[model samples]
Target: MSLSLVLAALVAVTDSATHNGRAGQTTVPAVRADTTIDVDGRLDEPVWRRAALLTGFSLYQPADGRPAPDSTEVLVWYSPTAMHFGVRAYEPHGPVQATLADRDRVSADDNVEIQLDTFDEGRRAFVFIVNPLGVQADGTKSEAGGFIPGSNVMPGQNDLSADFRWQSKGRVTEWGYEVEIRIPFASLRYPVGAPQRWGLQIVRHVQHSGYEETWTPARRASASFIAQAGKLVGLAGMRHGQVVELNPELTNTAAGAAAAPSGDWRYRNDAQLGGNVRWAVGSDVVLNGTVKPDFSQVEADATQIATDQRFALFYPERRPFFVEGSDQFNVPNTLVYTRRIVRPEAAAKLTGKIGRSDVAVLSAVDDRATTSDASRPLVNIVRLRRDFGRQNTAGILYSGRTSGARATTTSPAPTRAWCSAASTSRRCRRCRA
Candidate 1:
C-alpha cells in the first residue's frame, strides 16, 4: 500500500478565567427550566416568561457601543440535558429577508446568532445561527492572535464544517421575527464539572437594514470577540454523559464476463467494509477514529474571485475526522495542516482537557500514491504550550519526517502567542522549517 504514517501529540495549558475580560462582571443567569420548551418559534412556553431575559443589544457594525434602533429580547434557560434560547427581534427599519435555503447559507438573510464558549476559554466558540425562516447554520470559531507568516490564511476565521444534533424553529412576526433553539449537552464539550460558567453572546444581522447588533458591546477595537462576551451563570447540575456514535458503510461490486457464447458466464464479486466512530470519554475528552473509511467531500469549497491572486487559496477543513474538536489543534503556527493528509486508509484522534492542560493526539496512515520501493514515510509532530498573563501564550513545535533515504525536521523559534481580537498590541510567531 502507498501510504504515509503520521503521529501527532499536543499538550497545552491555560487558565480559562484569566483571559476572559468582563465576562464575570456582565452576567446573565441560565435558569433551570421547570417546564418543557416546545421549540415552535412562538415563545409560548411558560419557562420563557420565567427564564432570564437578555436585552439591551448594541450596534456592532457601522458603529459600536450605541443602543440599537430596534430591540431584541432573548430568553436563556436550560434543562438537565440541553440548553435553550428564545429570540424576539423587532425590526421596524426594513423588511426581514429570509429564504428556504440550505444550512449554513443564511448569511444573506436577516438572522440571529448565538455564540457559546463552553469552556469559557475566551478564544474559541460554537456559533449557532438561524434565519427568520428557521434555516440553521452552526460552526466553530477560532481566535488566533494574527495571520501566520507566509500564509494568506487568517486565523480567527469561522469554519462551518461541523454539524451538531440540535433543534430550532423560527417565525416572522409583525414586529420582527422570533427564533427558538435547543442545543443538547451531548453536542457540546465543556469542563467536567457542575456549576458551569460559560461565555455567551447573541448577534442579530439586519441585511436589508444594513446593521449588526450584539447583546454585548462588541467593539471593533476589542482584541478578542469572545473575551468581550457576557457570562452565563446558574448551570448547576447539568451533565453530558458519555456519547458513542458509530457509522458503518459497506460497498460491493459484481462483474461477469464470458469468453464464448456457449460458455457459462463467470462472475466476480467483491465487498468492502468501513465506518467512523466517536466516543465521548467524558464531557471534556473525546476519541474519534475511522477504519477503511469512505472519505467523501460533502460540501463544495466557497468561490473566491481572484483577479490578481499571488498566493494559494486557503480552504478550511471539512472532513468529519479533522473537524471534530479542531479548535484544540490550533497553534500559533500552522504546523499540521490536515488537508495535506490527502487519502488516509486509517486515522484516529484523541482530544481532551486535564486540569488546566489540553491534550490532543492524532495518528493517521495516508494512502498517497507511491513507487515500487513500497516506502512509507514516517512523520511525527509534537507541540507543547502554556498560556499565562491574559492571552499571552508560549509554545514549542517540532515536526520530523523520515523516509528510506530522506529526513527533514522543522523547529520554528517561538515568539509572542495568540492574537486577541480584544487586544490592540500583540505579535504572532513566524513558523519556519
Candidate 2:
C-alpha cells in the first residue's frame, strides 16, 4: 500500500465516535490569555479576570451531591503553546494539611488534582496533582480496563509512577491557599491545528474535614468518572512544537589480567553504543524506536518480598520507552504485556489517537528469554478502540510471537464493553463478542 493510503487507513477508521458535547454536560469556556501571566501563585494578572472561572463544587466523598463546606475557585486559560490554571482554595477554620515532600510522594497531604482527558477519551486521563506548598505528583489514570488481580494496584487510583514536565507554584495564606500551574503543549500529546474539546475535572481534598469535592457533580451513582467531567471548549490555534527527543548513550569498560606468571599484564576495553528516539507525528501520533537501547531501570522498584501468594508478583514498568504511551495498550485482562519482551535488542511503537479511535502498534525483538538465553523471539501487538456516545467503547486486540520456525498468534474476537468507574474496582457492566 502507498504510504499516504496507509496513513489514511490508520487514521480514517470512522467518525461515528466523534464527541459533540454530551447531553446535560456542563461546559467551561477556555479563553486565550491576553497578557503575560507569571507563575507566582497569585492571580493578580488582568487576564485572569476574563479567564473562565469554575466554582460551586459538589461533594464527591463523605457524602455525594451536596455542597462543600469550603469553597474553591479555579481559573482556566491557554496560550498558543501552553495551558494555564490559577486556583484559590478557601479554608475558614480547618488547618491545611501540607508538607515539604518530594514529587510524586504527597498523596497523604491535602492536595488539588487536575484531570485532563486531552483526547476526550474516557479510557485514560492525565492527572496533575499539587499540595498546598506546591509539591507535585503527576501520573495517568486508567479507567478503560478493570483492576488486575495481584497487580498491587487499587481501584480508582492514579499510577504515580509516571511523571511529566510542567510548572507549578503554591503558597499558604491566612484564609486558605493559592496555586498556579502551567503545562506546555509539548509536554502533552493532543490533536493540533484546530479547535479542541477536552474533558476537564478539578478536585480538592480538604484534609481536616475529610472532604473531597469536584468541580463537576461526580456522584457515586455515575458510571464513569471521565464521563462526568465537564467539557473544555474554545481551545484553538494551539501549537505542539516539533517534539523530537534523541537520547544517545555510550558505555565503556576495561578488564586487566596477568599473563604467564606476572610476565605481562594485558588490558582490553569494550565500548557500546545505544540510544532511543521519539518523534511526534502531527501532534496526534507518536513514533518511538530504539537501537540497542539502554534497558537499565533508572530507579529501583520497591522491594516485594515473595510470600505464599496465590498469584505471581507484578512489578510496575519503569522503562521510559514502554511507559510513554502505555495507557493506549491497556484493555480488560491486558492482552499486551511489554515486560514479557525481556532483553530487547530493538523495538518500535506507534501510539495515539486517529479520528475517534485509539491506536497502538508495537514490535520488539528480544535477544533472549528470561528462562533461557538461547531463545530469541519477535513480538508484535496491535490494538484499536473506538469511543462512541458517553462512556462507551468497543475495541479489538491482536498479539503474535515467533521464534525460529515456531510461531504463535492470538486474535480474540472483537469485544464491546462499557466500563463503570463508580466503585473501588472498575467493572465492565456488559461484554459481548
Candidate 3:
C-alpha cells in the first residue's frame, strides 16, 4: 500500500476502536484499582485520589503505518510527596539515536513527557520529559525574568530512582520487545484537599518505526498536553499542603569607571539594602511588598528572537521582591507591573482569595536613580476574579500611575476585562466549540 494510504488507515484505526480488527483491543495495560495510593497515605485507592496526572494521548502516531517495530505501555500512580509514572516500551526494530536540546538538555528521541494539572484545569501545571536513556528535563518559575535554565532543579539519581522503576519483558507477538516503568511520589507538587480532579497526558515516541500515540485521542503530536489532557476522576481524601507560600530576599551591587581627567581607573562599590515579603492569603490570593527592590537578576532578552512581535514575553522576576504567585494575578490585557517597576524605593503587594473571589493589589514608589528622568510615579493595580466553576472565570482589573510632582498628572491609565472557560468532556460545548 502507498505510505499515504497506510497512514490514513492508521489514523482511522486509532481514532476510534473500530477501524482495526482489534477494535476494542487496547495496547494499554489494564489498571487494577487495588494497586494505588491516596493523598492521605492510604493504599488501595486511585492515584488521582491525591494529585492530578496528565494524559498523554498524542505522542504516538504511525508515520505512514508500515507495521513498524516499536511500541510502549505506561502505568501511572501518585502520593502526597510525589507522583509515579512507568512506561514499558518495545523496540525490536532497533533503537533510534537522538540528542537533547533546550534549557536543560536531554535526549529527545523515544521520550515521554507527563503533563499534570492538579486542578483539572489547564491554567496551571508542570511538564516533565524523560528519555529512554534516563535523562530528565524540567522547567520552573523565577522572579527576575522568563523561564530560565538556571532555575531548574535537576532530579538526583536517587530522587529519579525513587520515583522510577523499569523491567525488560522480552517480546510481544509481531509488535516487538517491551519494557515497563513504575514512578513514585516525591516527584510532584499539588494542593491538599479531598475529591480532587486532575488533568493528565502520557506521551510516547517510537523513533525507528516513527509511531507515536496516546491512551486518549489527540489531534496532533506537537499539541501541548494541557490542551488535550484527559480528566482523572475519583479523588477524595488527599492531603496537599497549603497552596500559598511566602518568600523574602535582600541583595547588593557594585560598579567601577575610569575618566581621562583622572587618567586612572577608579573602582567603587555601592551597597543598597532592601527586602520584600510575600504572604499567601489563600489558594487564589497573595500579598507582596518591597523596599528598594533590585533588578540585577532580571534576565536579558533571548538572542535568537530579533523582533518584538508578540507582547514582550514577560519572565517572572526572581529578586524575591515580587509576590511568588504571579500566575494567579494574570489579567488579560492590563499592565500589571511587578518586575522593573521603577525600583519602587518602597512597595507593597496583596493577593489571595476572599470567599470565592480572587483579589490582588500593588502599590509602589519610583526611587531617585530609577525615577529621576521621569516624574517619580507611584504605581497601583487592583483586580478581582470570579470563578464560575469547572474552569470558567471572569475578572476585572484597574491600573494607574501618579506622578510625585505638584502637577499630579496621570495618563494612559488602562483597565481590562476578560473571561475564559475549559472542560474535559467531549460533549462539553466549550470543548466541542
Candidate 4:
C-alpha cells in the first residue's frame, strides 16, 4: 500500500473511535503574553488579564456526568518559551485539603490538573497537577482504544511514573484556591507548527466532598473522554528550539565476598562512568544514544509475589533511555522488555513521526542474560504504528535476537547470532493501567 494510504487508514480508525464521544468541542484562544507571569499563585499581571477564560464545568464524580455546583475559571496564555495558565477553583463550603508534600507527590491532595494533548492525538497527553500548597505531580497519559476510564478511584489513563520538571504554584484563598502554572515548551513534545490545534482538559478534585469536575464534561460512557476533550485553538508561533540533551553519571561501589561463611571477606572496588545524548532531528524525529549506560535501581522494589507463577511477572520500565516513548511500541507478546537486556554495553534508539505514522527503532547488545561468552547476542526492535480512528492502532513490529534471555550472562562478550521475525498487531489503550 502507498504510504499516504496507510496513514489515512490509521487516522480513520482513530477518528472514528474518538468521535463516538461528545461533539462541538469547546475552543479557547491562547493570547500572546504582553507582561511577565510572576508564578506566585497570583494572577495579578496584565498577561492574565488579557488571556481568554474557559469555563462551563460539569461533574464527573459523585455522578457520571452531572452539572457541577461550584464554579471554575481557566485562563490561558502563551509565549514563545512557555504556556501559562491561571485556574480559579471556587469552593464555598469546605476547607481545602492542602498538603506540604514533596514535588510530584501532590495529586492526592486537593488539587487541580491540566491535561494537554499537545499533539492533539487525544490518546496521549502531558498532565500537570498542583495542589493548593503548590506541590506538583506530573505524568503522561496514553489512551488506547480511546477507552473512557471506568472509575475515578482507579482512573486508568495516566502513567504517573512518567514525570517531568515544570513550574507551578497554588494558593488557598477565602473562597477557594487558585493556581498558576507555566510549562516550558522544551519539557513537552509537540509537532512544530503554527495555527496549532491541541486537545485540552482542566479538572478540579475536591477531597472533602469527593467531587470531580472537568471544564469540558468528561462523560463516563465515552471511552475516549480525554481524546474527545475540548480543543485549544489559535495556537501560533510555537517553537521547541533545537532539542539536545547531555547527561553524565558516575558511580563507585565496594563489594566483599568470602569462600566460606566465616572467612574474612576481601573488598573490591567498582567504579564506572556513563552518559547519554539526545538530539532531535528536526521536529519530527529524535535520536538517542548511550555509552556504558548504567541501569541501576535507585529505590528497591517492595512489592513481592510469593505464589508460584506460570509466567514471569511484569514490572514497569524505569531506566531513562528505555522509558521515554516506550509506550508506542506494540510488538506482539511484548517481545521488547528493557529489563531483560541485563547489561547493555551500549544502545541507540530513534523515534519520530512521518506523516501520520509513529515510528520507533532500538538496537542494543547485552552480555547479561546468558551462560558464557559463546552465546552473547544483539537485540533489535522496530515498531511502526498508524492511528486512523478514535483510540485504536494498527501496527507492524520486527524483532531480532541473536540468542539467550534478554541479557544476563557470564562474561562481557559481543553477540553474534540473530533471529528475526515480522508480524502485524492491533492494540487499543484508552487509559493507563
Candidate 5:
C-alpha cells in the first residue's frame, strides 16, 4: 500500500490508544509484528490536530481531589471581532445559589473569575480580570506590578458590564450555566500573528460547599495569573490595530505648618502636567514612555504592620521612572550599586527580540541630585542585556559620576567604570580584569 495509506492507518490506531478514556472507541488494521511505526509521523499528527482544532477545545485537567462533576465540560471559541466563551458546568447537585451582586460583594463562596491575558506568550501583556458579579479586579491595559494591592470596585463606579446568561436543570445535581463575553477588539490589545498562544485561568468558587477549583494549577490561591496560567493555542491570523490612549490628570496638594509650641496652618500647592505615550514598534515590541509622569493619580499603598523588629519598613519606590521596567536592569548581589545609580529624567528604551535572543536596554543620564552628594554620589547607569536563550546571556553595564570641586578654582573630578560579561550560568561573571 502507499505511504499515505499506511500513515493514515497508523494514526487511527494511535488515536484510539491515546483517547481510550474518551467516549469514542475504534480499531486499526493489524500490521506485521516486527513493524516499527514511524515515531516522527505519529507525533506530528497530534500537534497538527491541536493547532487546527480551534473550536470545542477543552482545558486539560489532571486527576485531583477537586470536586469536578463528570458532566462538567467547557467550550471555547473565537472570532475576528470578539472572543466567544461558553461553559457547560454540569452541577450534579440541585440548583445552587447563583446571584448577580455588585462586583465588590464577592466572597470566597460561589464566585467565578474570568481572566484574560492578551499577550500570553511574551513578557508584556494586558490582563483583564472580572468576577461573576461583574466586579473587575485589575482592569489595567498593561501588565501589573507584583507589589500593587488588589483593587475592588469603587463605590459609584459601576459602568462596566459583562454579557452573561445561564439556566438550571433538575436539582443541584443537574444544573447548567453559560456566559458569553463580547470583548471588543478596540478595548483589548494583543500581539498580532499566526499561532498566538495566551495564558488563561478560571476559578470557580462553591460558597455553600466551601470549595475552589482553578482551571490552571497554582501554588498560592491569591497569586496573580502571571505565575500560574495555562496556554490557549490555535490563534493564527490574529491582528491588533493601533493603540490609542488618552490620559488627562489633575492634582491639588495642601500642607499645614505648625510650630513646636504654637500651632498654625499654612497652605501650599504644586501643579504639574504629565502623560504617557504607547506605540507599537513593529508587531511584537511595544514602546512606552511618560512625560513628567505623575504618581498622584495612583492609589495609596495598602496598610501592613511590620512584625520584624530588626529591619526597617519596606517601601517600594513609587516613582514613575522606576515603574517602566527599570527594576529588571538591577544587577544581582549589587543592591548598593543599584540604589546609588542616578534615576534618569529622560530615558530611551529598546526592548524586543533580535533573532532568537531577547534584548532589553535602557540608556539614561542620572539625575543631578543623586550625583551631587559625595557620600551617596549618584552615577549615570546604562544597563544592557541580551538573553542568548535558557540561562545564557551577554551584558554590558556602564556607570559614572562627576564630583564637584572640593576647593576653589578647581574642576570636578569624574569617576567611571565599564563592566562587561557573558555567562551560561545564572549570574553574570565579570569578564574584565
Candidate 6:
C-alpha cells in the first residue's frame, strides 16, 4: 500500500474580532422572514424589501481601493434553517455579461460572489459564485495567513470543481439584472447558539472592466482578506437536523504479467467493493468510517509542473476522502502530507469541539504506490489544540508511518510545533514546575 497520513488536534482561541484587521467595521442586522422567497431573480419579493441593504463597493483586483464606476447593491436575510442574499446590479448602458453554462461553471460572464467565514476564525471560508445568467459556482478556501488560494478568479484561474450544494436564481430586467441566492445551514458549519456573528466578504466582478471590488478592502500584500472580511451580526437560535450519509461503490480492474521470454503471459480480472458512512454528532461534530473505501477521483489532479523546478513538488488533495475537515490538520511546515497516503484502502476521521478544545484524528492504510523506490505504509495522525489569551493557540501534532514491523514519528518542538502550511500553525506551550 502507498499512503500519506496527517492527523491534528487544534484548539482555536481568538478574539475573532481583532485577529485579522482593525478596519473591518462593516456590519449588517438580521431580518426574520415570514414570506417565501421565489428566487426568480426579480428582486420584487417582500422579504428583500425588509432586508438591510449593503452598498458602497470598493475595488481589490485589476485595480485596488478604487471606487467602482458602476453601482452594485446587496441585501441579506435568513430563516431558521437557511440564509439568503439578493443582488441588484444596475447597468443602464447596453448589454450586461451573462453566460449559459452548466451548474458550478459560471466564470466567463460578469458575476457576484459571497465569502463567509462561518466559524468566524481567521483561517477559512465557504465561497459561492453566480453569474448574471444565474449559473453557480461554490467551493472552500484555505486562508490561514501567508498563503492564499484563488485570490480574484478570472477565466482560467478558477477551479470549478470546488462545489457545495446551494441554489440561485436571476433574471435580466430593462435596468439590469437581479439575483437571489439560497444557502442552507445544513450545508454550512457553525457553532450552535443564538445571534452569532460571522465573517463576511461580498465581491462584485465587472468582466469588461476587470474589476474585483469587494465590500471591504483586501490588499494583495496582506493576509487573506476573508479573514479580514466584514461582520454579519445576528445568527442565533437555529436548529440543524441530524445528518447521516452512506456511500457504497464497486470497481473492476484487469492486469497481466509476462510468464516467459517467448511472450507468453498470465492475465486476470478483479472486482472490488467498498462503502463509507458519516454521522453528524449533533451540529458540532462528525464521525466517519469506511470499509475498503473506493474514492475514484472523477477529475484529474491539477499539477501543471515544469521540467526545470529545483525541488520536488507536492500536489494538493482533490480526492473527497482527504478533503473533509482538512482545516484541523494545517501546520506551518511540511510534517504530514495527505498525498503521501495516495491510495487509502480504509480510513476513519473524527472532527468536532469538546468545550474549549478542538480535536481531529485520522487513521489510514495504504497498499498503493507512492514513491518509485519505497513501498506503501500505514499512516496515523493526531492534533489537539486549546485557545487562550488574545488570538494565540497552543497545540500538539504527531504523525507516524509504519510498514511491516518498523515505524517512525514526527514530533513538535518543546515550546512550539514547526508551524508551516505544509505542517501546522501557532502555539504557546504550558510550563510545568
Clashes of each: 10, 0, 41, 37, 13, 31
lDDT of 1: 0.75
Model 6 C-alpha lDDT versus the unseen true structure: 0.70
| Candidate 1: stretches off by over 4 Å | 1-25, 146-153, 253-269, 300-315, 368-372, 376-381, 400-433
- The Cα error of candidate 5 at residue 387, in Å, is 6.7
lDDT of each: 0.75, 0.79, 0.47, 0.74, 0.41, 0.70
Candidates in order, TM-scores: namely: 0.79, 0.82, 0.55, 0.79, 0.50, 0.75
Candidate 4 per-residue C-alpha lDDT over 1-433 given as tens digits, one digit per residue, 9 for 90 to 100: 9999999998875443231112333776567764456789898886676676776678898786666777777788898778898888888878888989986677668888889987788777888888986788877776643211111112346666556767888888998988888888777777767788889888888888888888776877886767657887788776677788898978789998885777988889999898899887665688899877866753444475858677565555667787676766634344566666667778999988776689999998776445454566788989888978756678888888776544555677884432232123323243211
Tens digits of lDDT, candidate 6, 126-187: 78899986799887665432211212222113334345667898887777788989888777
Number of colliding residue pairs in model 6: 31
TM-score of 2: 0.82
Which candidate gets the maximum TM-score versus the true structure? 2
- RMSD of each candidate relative to the true structure: 19.2, 18.4, 19.4, 16.0, 17.5, 18.1
Clashing pairs in 1: 145-418, 145-419, 222-421, 222-422, 223-420, 223-421, 223-422, 223-423, 224-421, 224-422
Tens digit of per-residue lDDT, candidate 1, span 11-118: 111121111222222586567864566788888867776667777788889898788888887877888889998888888878889799899899899999899988
Residue runs of model 4 more than 4 Å from their true location after superposition: 1-25, 145-156, 255-268, 330-335, 369-375, 389-392, 404-433
- Winner of 4 and 5 under TM-score: 4
Weakest 10 consecutive residues, lDDT, candidate 3? 155-164
Ranking by lDDT: 2, 1, 4, 6, 3, 5
Q: After superposition, how far is residue 383 of candidate 1 from its true place, in Å?
A: 3.9
For candidate 1, report its TM-score.
0.79
Q: For residue 116, give model 3's deviation from the true position in Å.
A: 1.8
Off by over 4 Å in 2: 1-25, 147-151, 255-260, 263-267, 295-297, 308-310, 369-375, 405-433
